[model samples]
Target: MDARRGWLRFIGRRLNPLTLAAARRGSAPFTIVRHRGRRSGTIYETPIIVARRGPDFAAELTYGQSVQWYRNIRAAGGRCELARGDEGWQIESVESLPVAEGLAAYGPPRSWVLRLLRRHEFLLLRVEGSGGDASD
Candidate 1:
């Protein structure tokens, strides 16, 4: 696990800058998550894949729950900003969704890949003013 984490970190560092640029351009499957550091209070923008489920969004926890962005968002009252193309949303809440339920938010191919990769954890974000249950 440590080795995998190291590899992911290495790859992420190299790819993040490029990914962030594309994400800022409003690329599909890429969303820019703006969050603050839990300790340093420094702001960070992370690129992630998100799937819309009703008025909410679901993000696969590809790096599990221990990722810095996840921790920071959770620590800071589950509030963050998500930008996709020219659209933006104020995420009001974040919560873990059961594997089965979360998987339903994604299409078959993505769900299958995530399952094959053993990435079962997912975060469900509720957008402010977007009413309706997450399960809808």
Candidate 2:
């Protein structure tokens, strides 16, 4: 694995459980992404930092775009489950957004220094549930 991906694996594997727990309890800046594995078909739950962007949700590709969850989301035809608090929303569209536009939608970072080290790729996940649970 690449350096950043390695680091993310090291930390995320151990800490994501707690993060997912906190996110499920309605913690700020944390949300749970539920996706199916592309090849294995096993379901996985990953915790991500999501920001509201218009009618969609924005998540930074901090460890680059090669992460399994990112790829799985795309390979699954942009369909996934997003959990915030006690509710889970279905997503239909998962596309990359330009860094500047994503940053604008996500708002100014608390640390500009950290901002400089981030990747340009960001995913904009469009919620599919409108009046019902499966309509986008």
Candidate 3:
């Protein structure tokens, strides 16, 4: 068990709404994703950092493949709508990034994203679900 991972989990789980809101709206790329709960039938909205590869929009999940959000997308095999402020694009949930590649794609180990990779290799999820669910 990685002590660092545990600490990060603790922090994220305990993050206040204010900070989460700031992170979601700050200069860093932000997107609001709608996904179903793993065990529950209700859908939830979560804001995540947006990583762009050309026209494609991707997200780097800090919980790796085991993260709740990642699993939610996989479980429902549902579409994802990535929204930035008032603008957004629809994309499918197909591309998944593994550890080594995710780390490399995220770049140097000095950035916060690098730190996310150090604890949990991000999920390189792609978006392309056209005419999918974008409405609340």
Candidate 4:
């Protein structure tokens, strides 16, 4: 597990810059997630894949729930900003979803791939003005 984490860290450092650049250019499947660090309060922009689910958004927890971004988001009261394509949205709330429900939102291909990869953890992000239910 340590080796895998090391490898991922090495790769992420190299790939994140490029991914961030592409994501800013309105690229498909990539969104720029802007979050503030829980302790340092430093703002961070991370590139991730987000899928639309009704007026909300869904994302696979590819690196699990312990990732810094996820922690930061939670620490910030589940509020963040997501930039996708030429559009941007202020995420009002975020909640963990049951695997089955999350998978259903993803539909085919992505859901299948995620299932195959054993990525069962997912999050639902409700846009601020989307009128989506933000309650637990």
Clashing pairs in 3: 91-127, 91-128, 91-129, 92-127, 92-128, 92-129, 97-124
Model 2: CA > 4 A from native: 1-5, 110-114, 129-136
The weakest ten consecutive residues by lDDT in model 2 span 127-136
What digit string (tens of lDDT, one per residue) describes model 1 on residues 1-136? 6898888888678988888888989978789999999999999999999999888899998887888899999998999999978999999989888888778899799898888888889888989888745455
Across 50-95, the per-residue lDDT of candidate 2 in tens digits comes to 8887667878887787888999998999999999898788998787
After superposition of all CA atoms, the RMSD between model 1 and the true structure is 2.1
The regions of model 3 sitting more than 4 angstroms off are: 1-16, 23-27, 98-120, 129-136
lDDT of 3 by residue, 11-42 (tens): 56675354446545653545667677879968
Candidate 1 least-lDDT 10 residues: 127-136
lDDT of 4 at 88: 93
Candidate 1 whole-model C-alpha lDDT, 0 to 1: 0.88
The lDDT per prediction is 0.88, 0.80, 0.59, 0.88
Q: Native-vs-model 3 lDDT?
A: 0.59
Candidate 3 weakest lDDT stretch, 10 residues: 127-136
Candidate 1 vs 4: which has more TM-score: 4
